[model samples]
Target: MSGDDKYILVAQIGGAFGVKGEVKITAYTADAQALKAYSPLLDAKGQPALTIISARPDKHGLVAKVKELATKEEADAARGRKLYIHRDQLPEPDEDEFYLTDLVGLEGRDADDKVIGKVKSVQNFGADDMLEITPAEGGPTWYLPFTKAATPEIKPAEGWLRIIRPVETSERDAD
Candidate 1:
């Protein structure tokens, strides 16, 4: 991995919230409220771009006031800007629990040790987490549930994981 890719994206400025320079931040961290705790969030260039002065939960997301921005115009200018931090800044995950950043790009192998694909994205569309995998040969992506039954092992250090194929339960398959 390149030095620039070592940083993990922690949050993103969704948009300006109010007349004040507070922006709505969609946090990607484990704890959304902890976004403030990781102050001096960096930009993709690794520069300390934003410092959270205060953050509070709003209806949509966490409303945050940066150290210098003091007006809606200032915050609006930063909309869609992603906030990042060096990987070292984050605490290591517990056993069996890996950070989403660590899981992305990992080679996914089936129970027989056959490489199925590489992890493209990890998404949570309300129900639960899903892993979008792009096949090694280049085809349309398929999704696998981020559950124990589907993903029994994750070895980020080895850059791979074991996937248990889900059983087919459709009516056609039941015939």
Candidate 2:
């Protein structure tokens, strides 16, 4: 296992929120406030990065005070840092539910049970999460909606997922 895999990403530090060094952050956990429970999150290199002293929900995300980031300059400098918690600190997903991080590397199979792609990573753009699958055919990676309708079966322990590939048709196709 890699050092990077030893931790699960939980949040990302945004730019400084105020002149006081309080910064805005996007929390990936089910409860943003729950981030405090896993204080002193780590950076990519597995070094202590953020020790959140206090946090409150804001219109954008959470405004937080970090133990080490005491000044706005320090906070701004840390912007875009991804925060992680030791893997053991996170709870295993309850049956049928899985963490996005856990989904990485799962094989992507089609309805026919044929290899199609590999689960690359999870991405969220303010809406529901999406899976980036690296196509088995070796072209550009594609995005699949991480919904039961699209990815009906996800067997992380089994190391694979069943995807209902979407087929798009247009009026030209009807001609």
| Model 2: pairs clashing at backbone N, Cα or C within 3 Å | none
Scored against the true structure, residue 59 in model 2 reaches a CA lDDT of 59
Cα lDDT tens digits, model 1, 43-144, are 878888889888888655588888857789988888899888888878987876678878899999987899989999898899999999999889899899
**For model 2, the run of ten residues with the poorest summed lDDT:** 1-10
Collision pairs in model 1: none
Stretches of candidate 2 off by over 4 Å are 1-6, 170-175
Model 1's TM-score against the true structure: 0.78
Candidate 1 backbone overlaps, count: 0
TM-score, candidate number 2: 0.84
True-vs-predicted CA distance for residue 60, candidate 2, Å? 4.2
Distance from true location, Cα of 98 in model 1, Å: 1.6
TM-scores, all candidates, are: 0.78, 0.84
User: How many clashes (backbone N, Cα, C below 3 Å) per candidate?
Assistant: 0, 0
